[model samples]
Target chain A: MLRTYVDMNLVSGKQPHAWDLGEFYLIDRIRALVPDIDLTDDCAQIELPYEGTLLFTTDAAIRGVHFPEDSKYIADGGFRALAGAVSDINASAGKPLAALLALVIPPELTLSEFDRFLSGLLEYSRHSEVPLVGGNISRGDRFGATISVIGSSNKVVTRSGARPDDLVVLSGSIGGSEIGRMIISGEASDADIKSLDSEIIGTLLYRHLRPLPPLGLGEKLAAIGATSMVDISDGLIADVEHIAEASGVNIHIELGKLPLYPGVTEIAQRHRIEPAILAAESGEEFELIATMSLKDAEELEKLQMPMTVIGRVRSGNGFVDVTLNGEPIPPGFSEGWKHF
Target chain B: MLRTYVDMNLVSGKQPHAWDLGEFYLIDRIRALVPDIDLTDDCAQIELPYEGTLLFTTDAAIRGVHFPEDSKYIADGGFRALAGAVSDINASAGKPLAALLALVIPPELTLSEFDRFLSGLLEYSRHSEVPLVGGNISRGDRFGATISVIGSSNKVVTRSGARPDDLVVLSGSIGGSEIGRMIISGEASDADIKSLDSEIIGTLLYRHLRPLPPLGLGEKLAAIGATSMVDISDGLIADVEHIAEASGVNIHIELGKLPLYPGVTEIAQRHRIEPAILAAESGEEFELIATMSLKDAEELEKLQMPMTVIGRVRSGNGFVDVTLNGEPIPPGFSEGWKHF
Candidate 1:
């Protein structure tokens, strides 16, 4: 049932702990699904190839399957659980570079509680300069963290580059990491948090415990052309049906042009849950869902962090409709979060 | 009680699972400790300042701490517990290259019993082309195996370059891996099977389950002119008291010029133990202990895997002595295998 992409304009960026807005809309949807790498910054320029291109990816976070045991700072929850496996190689725009990490703990841990979970993953990799390079400390019988990153993308954003009428966009906002996991799972009630909106529930519990993606906007949406991309860590109708089954095409959306944030429709009417199924199955909400050309979304709405269109693409293959007023609404019954 | 270096030597020439042994004897043992850069074999000739070099080391093996928990490829017990942490960058003659693997397992395992422990570590890293690259699967809540390797050294072998009267050498043989973990723990019996010498009990159970070090022979003893270097991975009197406390001095040795092997004194007289404390603390011996200049061990004993001498150096400070018959002896009760 994977379908996310609840779209609040895919994280609006302005640097929360380091530029948020759902990590600049999943680096503008992995710079339009990697247009020959260079995810934009913080060192990444590989050349070696006798057997190069082996940058694999794997990220598991379980324990209530993704945070909240006593929540927050188990070393930025092991630096956002190894920054969601180096944000799937920075959402394929690539270059989050080197990682293996593999932790598991839980057997009533201690070695100084795994050194405060490696002091919050070495101060979130020394404030994200990212260099714990390789890892694997164990005990596990389950507490989970699993990482795998190995970046180096001189150019490679793949999800099958979108086409047809294109223009889907996003990059931020969706359901405040599903109303910050319903206020860390009490299922929100302090009188439904006095009819909420506290600066959009403190930016949806700071996008569910510090998300901040959009680093170097995936080489500026593959240097301004972007046709297709992914990374909405399952939401927005399960990451646009994985960009409609990796670009074969057909997407649609428009549930009254979705972009909600003010108390996610009264916390989806006090937990009956359907503010687009807590923004379509709430995953980590990394954001980014590209597919350009509405004249490059009017020149990416004159950059400075654009992308917000929300839906189009055609010629059929996957989720061919979502509508709302015109009918079809069977599109918001939880469409993400799966592990096993 | 930490001492182990399961009697050294793996010998064999240049690259075929690569092995050079030189960085001129690890820049005569760590060029006065740290910073010199550019070391090559070409392939972007070195120069990696900080975006890399996180390399770490951890080794552990215990059943009797380093082997024999039942054999016949009990998955070369996780490929000699990751070739004893890639024999500490092949005892600083360097090259281990990459690794992150962290297995703890033991809940009486099964998943086809750890797929023959990843098929004896992907057949010894596909016969040593080095590449387990990423890892961290867990369960261990401990039968034995700790491995932690993370290599890349063109010039990093440190034990403090032995000066004084130099020439200590060794790179091979020493109470054959405690006579192959006493014939895989039956403490030697197989009753006179084949009236003794089965080619020195099959080269002491193939150097106690493949201890093989020699890889990139520390960049060919740091491109010749060897000086200092370690890698006997504990023992040889605690790795010559860690190169006589990092080359402050003393050393000596002799004990009828060590070496031993061929049915190591009939497997230390059927396991009564002492063959010099099972050649000083028997552990998975990867070998190495360098230090040269007797005109670079008579010009690296005219090439093709040479080295041997067996001891010297003087000026004193870290005391290591040894001799036998011609005198000394004392420094007995050796110590090596110490975790915690």
Candidate 2:
């Protein structure tokens, strides 16, 4: 019987490329028991209509790079990684079907510690209904996780489809997420973030730590005829440039008209930062910026997520211009955060 | 224009979750020019036929873990990773459609070195006709890539489908791959592996380094009604257990009948190792093992790749007993490699 094989203590020969026995499928099976998930963009939609277009995209979170190195934040790292991947699908107006995670666990991480991180992923999968189908694991010197999501849809909203005269709309506020990250890292202490307002500080921290993408908004925007769409992973300029370049159109975002998280201005003021620039330059918001016709924008603004009109598309070749308040920004204005 | 933003020298306030500017999308765009790929298992096949089954699987190669730590092996790591992924699709008798990569690059690696690794993946994608559609990148202290491949097929051969009286088959020789690994690591010096015929060493090294799983053989076996199939990643006993456990039957391999790689016994002789055990426990040999009716096996034996009937399925509860010649294997028989 195979039971003998498991109990034998005889030395097995060299195991060059294999992990120790029994560890191979255990993590995946444990996660499968927890739940399933999804994360995606298009191989095709317009060109291969009704063939069931598949949307593909990948996102990553690295300890000491994407987040702090504290093991306590491991689960948050898992949640953040999944949110970033699924938001791409939301941008495409597609439902996430499955997510594959690649995790590099440093030697110091106990199996229990790693399971804590996996819990974050499992919780999100159950919530999003995007099952964690399977992933690969490797031992390394640092902790890193990368997730690839595949989705299916009858239609897709693409970055390349924005046109001149389209209105830019944001699904929610910005600047909160970046500030939230600061609070979590202890960089914004009671001298600033906590002193101003605990509720506000707590909200920002929560947004940064355990954010979920707006569940079903992209489809609504797509249904109402959005010309282009992008999830706000990076700051305004960094991510929107993808749409601007791909669409071959100029974009002009008005800083004054930007929708901002409530306490963002106070935080910017305390730090001697320009509030408008902070809002435009913030990253990790995971909200959405979409372009559509004025009528469609009007319909969108009335939706429950508090969508706001922020900019307009213009005819140009792959560039975006901005106005602070019907005037060009100061020459030495702080540049936006470039979240690649 | 956004050009003004890229040229400014002002310091960024903070970048908690973003990579430095201008590095975004460049790698994906470059690899997109090269090609795309795929890698899979069942979300469904038999349960949901006529409505395209999506097969999913992930494989990873980490520096110092799956392979040696030399930077020269980077490209081969890429190739091996992709091959390991696509081979899963082959086992399901499915066509691979697209592949997604999640890469963690060490901080010291230069862009050119990284591009060399990318070229390895791109080359295989072109050869296999599996497009490298999209992937994520992050900087860390260790290099790793996990690939997730999705495939489509109307019919799939599952591991749970084997039954009593089914004959087990090996698609090609084994044990050679482990030896090949030894030669590459320089562990098997001229006093050992190099003492063999140079052609045999070259063939084995080639087999270990750039193994492309017998591409079309799996589908052919499925077409001939192969009852169960699995790609030989780990050695014979470890992987066969998966089928036995899944199918609720016993498997038995006859050591005398195994199609040994040329020179395996010669090399095993030098090390005072059992040749039969060496053949049984070698890992990372991506050849396949399949079970089918004896009549179907007879028809499959005529294929071009030289399939060999080495074992048989018996009525038992997931235990694989083996015999060397007509005698049972020795009680202290060497155990198989435990590749996770």
Candidate 3:
């Protein structure tokens, strides 16, 4: 009998209205879902046995801007939101301890949709071993969530530690998420998504929906003597520019050595756009870009980490220079992503 | 000069567009405003000195719900948002160290409005000595802020430790914020607000605009052997019910003993409503509600901590009972504030 109500409320789309259920009922439901959460208190308490530094980061995903409201990817939206927040912890070389989620929901959204979102969030939390310790829900005109991740680290990495003679490393490939977003946002037709090989479609959709940041790899990089690091949240050039400005050094990228996804060139050609533009300008990649010494980079390479050195730091005013085919590239090659 | 550009951009309302200035440009402005914040990293790191527990809490303030979009109370909304978040730390007998803010802004909001909101947030951070370590800004239909407070304590107090014979104490008065909201939301007329005395208006507005939570009081209560504690963000009855349910004890409140705001009676009379209902149903009180032994309660009273004993815990199934003039109160007396 209880299972019937649960299924009706969470799967059949025949659930009581949120206004009728009230806030406490929703909180009770969440508590039942995440039983480890301490919902009886005003604040969640976490004990730290050893002395360490606490790392904090917050990220938000809006309905229209970050995800489509009308699409069937609501669960994917939740996964992406939490993953984006956890990616910051990964970038900092810290072990995530817990997370706090604040969700703003529109009245038009149904309980089943909310349940799917929570399922996605819980799935990530269970996989990452970071419990959802605290949260708040409020009414809003559109659905959105702000996820704050709390982490701890013995040795913290910052974006201002790179030196002049460091090699810049790119973790894995970029531009895949942008391609996936385009497909999900209907910029690409259903036939376009279907005509693509299943592996490519699956890979692109997975990358776009649940872009997993390689956790623990950041700590390994830190141990291997990475000087500075940043996540590719706002595209390669833009994010690297942050490291350059913060470290007060110039970065020269060997464009010919840039890493690209397998089908990026074909997709860009089909879309009548340059592959370099997609590689440089696509955002939400969630890949780490770090700077290290040549010896450290060689050691990391030997360890078989999925990263490639694509640039070198120089002593100059903070600016990024690009070279292609052993020649200085002209200005306006790839402006990178701009968010406002 | 930079000052001219700032004034023109912020005050003259003829500023460069947000899209033109870009997200990074706004972040730079915020960094300049709060110079102590470390903005050059993906995560801000805080060192934990010794063995202790970390307290985490998050709260959100939506534009239409928490404050009117057309009203000039945007700054007050910001102040209330941070204060409400900090109140959770106070409830747990914790000292806040830092906060992370995530703001969603509409495109129509001016640069000056955003500046004022930040000013309000910074003012609270400065006064509380809790730094704004990190935050994220994104676009949305209406302005809203989610504030996550990180705190620490040697001994934490929760809401589940009250004994059967414990006494319930309230730190301060209630119902002023609700009255102020009525006025601000235009449910009450300008004449209704004006007919009230200046002192009453000032007190109500102050309580409404910037609800102050007694932070050190919770710690002091914990040190003096408080069994359980909670902050009255919801309402007196609603919040006390939380302690009762968590502690697995019944709470009986003496209606005549409630600490009501000075103008509560007058405002209730003017509105043709019962003062008890106002005291019981108002939200955002931000006052500490604690449970302790009679001896500790007496000691606290002797210290003149602006608290009064309103109820006592009894061994029973978790429930709240109300009494008036030594008579048992009936059901549906005070339904309390409902958030939906």
Q: lDDT tens digits, residues A247-298, model 1? A: 7788887756667655777878876866755675567777666777777566
In model 3, residue pairs whose N, Cα or C atoms come closer than 3 Å (at least 3 residues apart or on different chains), thus clashing, are none
Whole-model Cα lDDT per candidate? Answer: 0.57, 0.71, 0.82
| Candidate 3 CAPRI grade | high
Misplaced by over 4 Å in model 3 are A1-20, A189-195, A332-335, A338-340, B1-20, B190-195, B338-340
Candidate 3: tens digits of C-alpha lDDT, residues B194-293: 6789888878887888888887887888888899999987788888888989989999988788778877777777889877668877888888889999
Q: After superposition, how far is residue B172 of candidate 1 from its true place, in Å?
A: 12
Write candidate 2's Cα lDDT for A1-340 as tens digits. 3224434523353222212323544354354555432111001011112244577777778887776678787788778888878888888877677777777766566544566678887778778887676666666677777777777655677888889999988887888877777667666666886556678877887687778889678778888888888877667766677789878999888889888887888888888887778878787787888899887776764566788888999999877777888887643343445322
Chain B only: TM-score of model 1: 0.35
* C-alpha TM-scores of all predictions: 0.32, 0.87, 0.94
Task: Say which prediction, candidate 2 or candidate 3, comes out ahead on lDDT.
Answer: 3
Candidate that scores best on TM-score: 3
